[model samples]
Target: MGVEITTHVLDSPRHRTSYLSAGPPDGPLMFFVHGFPGLGAMWRPQLDHFAERGWHCVAPDMRGYGGSSVPTGAAAYAVAEVVDDMVELHDALGGRAAVWVGHDWGSEVVWSMAVRHAERCRAVVSLTVPYIPGGLTLEHLTPLVDRSLYPVEVFPLGQWEYMQLAIDEPELVAEEFAADLEATFAVVFRGGDPMTLGTPSFTSIVRAQGGWFGPSRRAPKMDRDETVLSEELLDTLVRAYGKTGFLGPHRWYANAGEELRAGRPGPGDSRVRPPVLFVHASWDPACETVTSRLAEPMREACDDLTEVVIDAGHWVALEKPGDVNAGIADWLGKTLRTGPHPM
Candidate 1:
């Protein structure tokens, strides 16, 4: 048979991270980090592909997700704490300087990992979100918002108005999402719509409408977008969210101020010397990098960076797995000189 995915739990001194692994134990390590409202299982496609190609691939459910430990307070979810978790997990898994890959909030963690613990990372890859040396928060993000799509007069927060909702009313956002988990997942997990190009993303109006689902204050019922969320994955997500609730995930935003302050640039912050790959989701308007200045900081900071544009939305990996895998495989081939297997 082929490589089989296996679940493994690693307990760090501070927290516990549950992860899925494939490939031989001694193979070159590759850590795949997931984002908000997502579990390690979200990287199933990547894990399978990389494992078959002779890489030891591991994807972890970050703190407050899946089988991972859920800390008591929002402050516990700060970037520093999250980075510590990744570092500790890396150590527990043989302490090799491994390739780090992330998407969305996971990308935020990879950016930090490359900075705070560069010794542990061989190379870094991010999808959807790019690195900001000063930190990826409202302070740095707000100035970069595409003002044309969101006129400062009417949309002060731009597409990130919902982020303010997370900051100002974390509990409310969590409660609303937890109130109707299935509907919430269905609404949140859809594939990108090409028709949304050039138009304001749905996120731009979160503040004006009072919440993700407007006055309803809950996620509206939606069919699972098969293009992005398959039934198996949907079932997996529903079960994961059911146990952990939205509190842990939403807390990620609640700790933004503290995280950003800690992440402010210092002496060597401007340089990320490792070969880097940034995959731009062309249809992800809210995290829109294709037409916005949001990616400029990442471009300026890195010495060797390659960019690819995928014709999918925010959930590019799930929406177009083949394209993503091809991009990554190509990158791995050109960037590193290692053989497929450890032998």
Candidate 2:
């Protein structure tokens, strides 16, 4: 059976925001947040899968993406504001504490929700990015670096370099990259192997290489990895992103601040009291887990957390939807056998 779908557009002056909801109004709800340079539609596959299995899935365009309200002020994109939107969204749906899932920047937002507004999340599933409790600032993130992969002196900037580029030339970066959205999506979403780890930081290459696509102004052709994402699926993504210039979505990075950038829980900081799940992308070179040491600290922080490793790259949900869905289903079975009550 097809799931029911509804969407809302919020206008915040800077941009138009769109959030799509699927499945029955009364079904268990799951909020899916997308990462940088992506819109709510990035969660299409997961939303389709979960909605069919009695989940009311909601995917938002976030503050600056799609039809959502986008305020020009960077402060509007703070973690607190994003978390507030989730809470308000839940209340609008006649429910509270939906199973929250995020990927990339979305993962950061979901992490903040669990930490700052634990009461509003029944459970959380974060993909790619892990929970870094503390203030979400670049200054606070220095200690969490795996020194071997990212040396202090040369790479102190780390991912900040990429962020800086985006912030400095948001329009140029968006227009240049979005010129061929297909090639851009393919290169960015191309799955890496589980064997490659501790490679030189990509952040270091940004200024010299001119962003993640390397020296090329446009993305080069990438080999199709059918095992991870099908050609048709890839085509759909290309079309979606192509139609929506990345400026609205990419700006979310500039919108975030030092606190949100840190992503680590702080002393006396709010803990994620709700049941949380983290699905590690085993082959994600950027957030590698072959070291084990990388995820160990996160496991120790949450009171109720579940960790599952999927043999996929940064795009875990897209690369291994079955495993992702199953991991989430298993968690839901154990945690939400009885559906959530209306708030």
Candidate 3:
């Protein structure tokens, strides 16, 4: 909060972007993009840290989450379109190929940028979610499931069942989360446990259980996980989801299978040519990467790659900000020092 971060807006015929700006305007540019159920403010800790290090930081509320434009349909939240939004935001921020850092679904967008617009990137850093080569659709992910834990007979899609729920019953999923944003955040943002790495994730049973809260179709009442969420962030999330509802966030995953089949993101578009840093959230069962095949595509495709494992949950950035920051900072420092630069 000491870094004097300011909010700004950009409006165009197609969309609107509301972003938080910190550090000197002319300093080395870096962008932090948030994913589903997140706002620009989710990156406040990151923005402040990097800004203090003399890096101009910008974190934008991607398409459906905060002050940004909330388009009505799922197609509007596609990777190509979302990348276009970032392209515009990047251009607006002086057209510098920045060091782009992202999390969750944001990583998908960042990877797409590396594929489609490599020239606009100085480097790419992704936390929790790894680069999925083509895209993060179930098609690519289903094959990568740890079959020993998620057998084909029962857990067809493994930990991604909740995504299937979102894709199948989008409105209901949204309404359930929107019904009690506080409780929703409380359950969703809990810290990860390394003990449960081999165990099945709760997300695997969402469809069979008849939604996130089982038959109740609402989030169960629980105290917020202070280890993963601060009161300010919880309140900000409640307020934001209260205004926008969860539909827009869910929409981001809608039609994902079809989109991949149509080659909008091109499953074959796998090679990544930027200095990449992937943070493995060892305790995060859902986005499990350390022991799973999920990260193989990224490793094979990215010629310049660095990997670090953090013992935190899917909310790795919030659960262990120091580790996440240090990982990225180390990667950046190494990248800059070994100059073939223009990542």
Candidate 4:
């Protein structure tokens, strides 16, 4: 069934946000943040599920993507700025802190909020992306690199080559990518096989092969594989991203400087001492479990943290909505002392 959806645009540095809300009144607020190449609508499944449970579900089209303002400069898309926008959004909704949940880059922003603005977040759920402390940067993560998949010689820049492509020519990259949003979405969201970790690094293949879809730059047919993302859903994403282009979302990578990338504890670091939950995507390529090490630091930073592993791609909410909803409901019941509402 379709969920009640309400969305607004909040002006940030480069772009505005299409913030969508769902659920019943006086219910616990659950804030959602979408990842790269995704808009707030990505959480439709979760919104539908949670709203039935009488919870206020919110998903924002973070900084540069969707209906939000698309600022020209990369500096505007920093994690800090994104976090601040969320904080303001939460305040505007009500004074109370909501159950914060983020996916992909949005997950990174949620991590920042949990660390820097604990008071604003009652609980935290991060999908795909894990919390890396201030010290861990792309450089630091290089050592943990599975050399088998990504040979240092060829993929020296690691997964960063994609970022380079986006940063070097935002408009061209967007235009080139805009030609076939469906193909791009399909190719981009396709999760990597875990077994391949021991073989050639997929990141390397994409880089060495000159882009993800090979030299052609054309995305393949939209095949419903393990992702479970429906054609209607895929079309929604295509339309939203196709209109805005990826420049704003791509700029998020460039905006995250050493300070945000490092993830150093700022003034509000200790504030996220509440019950937190992290849903790790077993097959997420970007924040690959077998490749990227996120579990360790998350445990260290969050005094009360719950971790769940879902056999899905980076789009965990859509891929495993039942599991995701169950996890959230279970945590809310135990911690927030609430029960799921009937649809």
Candidate 5:
């Protein structure tokens, strides 16, 4: 709470993105991108820590989230459009090359930024989701699924079946989340579970169950998971989703096929030459990269890759902020060599 976060809007002809900023306006920039069902506030912990370390920190409410413009149509949420948002935001911030950090769908955006606009990125860090280089389509992702935990015979779609839910039954999935927004947020922001390792993640069964909550179409009532979210933070997220609804976020998945089709890579587009750090959530059963082949593409694509495994779930930054911050700090010190006590 050393520096208060200030809100600013980047308005463009195509879309409007709202963001939270802290630290000096002219300091080296650090942009934090949040995933689906999350706001710029999700990166509060990272923002505060990095800002204290003398970096200009900003986290944007990506298009279709929070106060940002929620454009209709799934195609509007494609990676190219989201990357364009980042490029424009960087330009609005004075065109300084900055370190980029992302989680979930945000990772996809930053990865694209590194590829499509490398000059704007000094370094990149990804949480939970790794850079897929070729783009993270079901066609590219399904092959990397761990068949042992999710056997092809029974769980044909693996942990990514939920993605299919968005494609095949978008309205139903959206209705289920909107049925009880608070409950949905409560369920989504829970801490990770190590006990579920090597097991089929609930995501793998979404299609088999007909939907996220099956016939009920609503998340089960539960208390907020304090390990991952304080009551204040949870309430903030619930309110944001309540106002914006889940259709825009879910549109990310609906456009996966199109993102893949339109995102065909040029020579070297898949490879990231900048210093890259990928933080793997060890307990993330859905995006299980620690014990699966999911991270292989990232390993091969990045020439300066440094991988760290945190014993937390998909919401690693929220559930274990200390470790996440420490990992990033350590990586930045060693790799970037521009910290206060640079090596």
Candidate 6:
């Protein structure tokens, strides 16, 4: 039998963190952080792969997800708050400078760590989302949207209009997504569709449409996208979201201002100095780094940056796990492991 991935919980004075861990306890640390409506289990592929190679892999159920403490109020889910939770967790796990990996909103958390406090991380690998040193706020992102694809007159906020859901109607957003877990997961987990490349993502019109499923109020019935999800993984996600609901995840969108403010230069640290590998989702309409200028800030902000374009959708890590793992392994082997931060 392979090395078993173990579940652990740290009850710190600040909060309770439930994380999945593998590899030898004394091995080099590789922390994996997930995004909205996700658990630490979402990173099972990367966690298992890295663990087998003598890297201690830890994927945490961030603040409001899975087995972690789900604090009430959107203010409690701010970027600074989540960053503190992670740093505390890091301290409990031996206080070593480890390589951190994140996807979607998790990218924001890791990036916040590097920008706000670089001492905790040796390197960072981001999937589908690039490092935005100034945070993921629309104020920092809307100007970077593809104007041709999302014209200002038509799409004033670009594909980020959905962010308003958190501000305008948080309960409704949570209620709708939690209304039917299976259909919601299936609807959102589809793999890339090349035909939808330059088209306006559904996110651009979320405000006008009212909700994710418009007047329907819940996800439309659809088959789970097996291309991106294993049956076991899918079931686990449903149960996690079922238990937590969507309030905590949706609250992440409400704290963009604080996140952006937290990323500004302090004291001597301005640019992110750690080795960064940004994995872009080529077919993701909302984050089209290949075509849009969405990745420009990241290019200018990082002193040491590596870029790889993966032919997949938003769920690049899940849909193309081999490619994602290969990209990170190549970067780590070439940049950190063999060069400086050896395992």
**Model 3: CA > 4 A from native:** 257-269, 338-343
- Record all residue pairs in model 3 with backbone atoms less than 3 Å apart, i.e. clashing: none
Better of 1 and 2 by TM-score: 1
Per-residue accuracy of model 4 over 10-84 as CA lDDT, tens digit each = 554433456888887577788888887888888888898888777888888877777777777778777777776
RMSD vs true structure, all candidates: 1.9, 3.7, 2.2, 3.4, 1.8, 1.9
Question: Can you write out model 3's per-residue Cα lDDT over 1-343, one digit (the tens) per residue?
Answer: 3699999998989999999999988888899988877888988778878898888899999988788899997788777778889999999889977889999888888888888788888899998888777568887899999999999899999999998899899898988888778889998889988789799999999999888897787888898889899999999899888888888889888744333345454656557888899999899889889888999888888979889999999888898998888778877887866433211
TM-score of each: 0.95, 0.85, 0.95, 0.86, 0.96, 0.95
Minimum summed lDDT over a 10-residue window in model 1 is located at 256-265
**Per-residue lDDT for 82 in model 4?**
75
Q: Kindly report which residue stretches of model 5 are placed more than 4 angstroms away from their true locations once superposed.
A: 257-264, 338-343
Error of 6 at 193 (Å): 1.2
Q: Which run of 10 residues does model 5 get worst, by summed lDDT?
A: 256-265
Weakest 10 consecutive residues of candidate 3 by summed lDDT: 256-265
- Please estimate how well model 3 matches the true structure, expressed as its whole-model Cα lDDT: 0.85
lDDT of 3 at 224: 82
The lowest-lDDT stretch of 10 consecutive residues in candidate 4 is 196-205
Per-residue alpha-carbon lDDT of candidate 6 for residues 223-306, written as tens digits (9 for 90 to 100): 878998778887998889888999988888888647555555543455788889999999998878898888998898898999
Over all chains combined, what TM-score does candidate 4 have? 0.86
